[model samples]
Target: MDGAEREVATLLEQLQGLTSNAEQVEGFRRVQEIVQHRDPSGAERRVLRGALPLLGQIVQLRNAALVTSILQLVAQEASSASSTVTTASAETLDVAAALSAGLYEVCHTVLLLSHSTEKNVVLALQLALGSLHSTFEVALRAETVENGLDTEPRRAWDAATRCLEAAAGIVAIVPEATGSDSNRSAMVWLRAWKFVESGVMLLSTAQDSSVYRDPARSNIQPNTWSLDRLSAGTQAILPKTKLEEFGVMLLKAMCEAVTSKSDNRLPLQRRELSVAVNSLSLLASLRPQHMPNILPKLTALSTVVATPGTEDPVVQKSLTANLVKLLSHPSAQVFADEVTDILIAVGASQRAFSAISKSKEQRRKYTSAPTEASLRRARIGKRTATQSITERVENANAHAKRRRVNLSESSATPIPAEKHWQLKKVRSECVILGSGETQDSKHRAKNNQHWCQFLMK
Candidate 1:
């Protein structure tokens, strides 16, 4: 690497060390100087990007005192810049965007940490309101509301619907207005609402309530990219798949599948549903492709049956009332003649009747990432021979005899499709970046190249 790049790389390592309280002051002081003295147009911009890890660390700290301090600092600096600041630099808007994003991501993450104390949660919400306050105040002086933050780690926008709605419903928004004249109760609520949408969008990118996660959904392990053919990331993927984009889609579609309007039927995006079932059938050596559209309907029903918070045992019973229902009903024959966990999850009393678990072991061989494939192959092979014998036995029993029988017999049947799901575990082990080493590691790795210190910690 060139000398300039090496210098920037070194800066990232130093920044990560700014985590303790004493170092924090120095961190902010440097930040203050950057916002106050540097321009975004040149090499200083790289410094700004490199500096974000400290900001990320700040958000992770969850100390109300620190959050408030940074909030006020960013707001004060942006507002104090001269009106001519618009022509001289894009500083106000950029800083405001960064602060808003930081606030939203941190608050949203904190609320999701089921392990956090009530105090931390309250502080997070308060930080949220402070962020909102800065958002609107910035509007009073800043020219635009467009975001200029990096998009790695992807914002949780799709999950922000509720926050946006609540922000819109607040009463007595704008007030009477004039030039810094009246001691204030005279501000324009209407103009404030104009920025409200943008403001809401900014916060909702995170601070999005619908996306709140339980600590149950956090990361399982770090992906340490090593040189040897041996790798270990596969064990990490399966647990969190259901919380991914497609998994969320699967969850949403199943929840909406059979409304009161559709008694005998279940609805789903047949295309995506096929991709999923197809993968399962192909892997299990079953032929679900025979009734492409027909089987997925049953599969969607199975998902709804397994989804957490679905309390009505009647739904499970209605599905189980008769044996013929098992074969002829929509979900019964999902993959040709195979009776499977797909049926068991819905309370099928008889033998599970399908073969899906054993086939999953084969999944290791097909993994494509060289590192991950090696990792899985080595771990599963070795672990299976000795350490994983019990786990392997448990894996088989999970699909075969014990749980399936109990499920068929009891009304309290919750087929253990995925372990550790919430409200009784619906198989949602997503990689939550709320607060922990995993969050810090992933966030750093995501921004490391262009904007961070070190790869994922």
Candidate 2:
């Protein structure tokens, strides 16, 4: 081996000895120095790339200090790469690809721990997930421009999808295991919502197909990639097949989770429902090739909710609301409006059926301001003097205050005025009787009461 290659190998070995946080930070400090060198060798570049997965190992052990170090390194490297105005080179491309791959591995490993019962472990995993998601995204954009249709970018996306799957699993399992009423369950469900939201956001990139297309054929031969295999290789049949499969599986699972009841419990929480619907809406917006089949599956689930004796009124109402949202969706226009009747049959209120129409009308009226006073009349009733919203709020507050005063008065103790007066009069008579000196004193006291004495005379 060459002297430079030997030196690079030795440096990497020293990096492995970085057992302490201080040592790791110092090691990365030197690595950064090497990166900033005017002409870094391929071996040095490899060392930098190799260090990324090592950080993943530290993260696996759930070491807070090491994890922080790794995150800072990622941020530093990413910021430096993005902010630089230099021309791209083959070595730079390699570093970017390696960084992307390592970050993906880290995210995938962390996500596998998402279902942990330990709060700390779960929290760390979530942090790792967020870091990996953002880091991988930036790397993908940078690398895709340099190395068009590269497998590394596709692999990065797959890692993100896998992370989402792990997150969703955590969401489903925690509530089921903990009886849905525990504090832990609530927190885990919250994490689950975050994961779902992230997953949807990640999937949103598909809206721009040019940015997220399958890898093109390489000179190596008839080249293609699968979800399981994102790199350019001699492939027999299809590309992105597995990715499509994963998307389908994810959508189906989410739909079922949102709609199906858990024995006696309600279907997923309301938040989960909203997140799931949002994810599905995004997926639908992407106009996936398999959406026709997916839409039918979604509609079938809603149909069962419409049938009698499946869920209680509250569950039915929630499911119906989601279904209505789906039907009124801009993406779902291709699907028939049959869901309205299904909703009504399932005991959806009349308001629920007319909700979409009303919303459309409201939007239309807002867009086109009416000049005619008659057209501007209130739909619900006659306008009451056209008060400003602020004025209305003030009036409402005053009314509420009056109601509060009335309520306080109604709950207050009686004043007992009559009893008080009678008590005072009795006390005065008692005092008169107690103070009397004798019959002569009594006659003098009676003479002092002039009106009564005159009447007696």
**Could you say which candidate leads in lDDT?**
2
For each candidate in turn, the TM-score is 0.25, 0.51
For 356-436, candidate 2 gives per-residue lDDT tens digits of 564344221111223456445653255455556656889999999998897687557453676556545544443253553
How does each model score on lDDT?
0.37, 0.49
- Residue ranges of candidate 1 with Cα displaced over 4 Å: 1-12, 18-20, 25-27, 37-50, 61-68, 71-99, 113-123, 130-457
Worst 10 residues of 2 by lDDT: 216-225
RMSD of each: 32.3, 17.0
Q: Give the alpha carbon lDDT tens digit for every residue of 97-173 in model 1.
A: 44445445555544444343444444444445444434433332232323422232122122122223232322122
Which regions of candidate 2 deviate over 4 angstroms? 1-47, 79-90, 113-165, 168-245, 259-263, 267-274, 281-318, 330-338, 345-457
Cα deviation at 322, candidate 2, in Å, is 3.2
Worst lDDT run of 10 residues, candidate 1, spans: 220-229
Q: What local lDDT does model 2 show for residue 280? A: 54
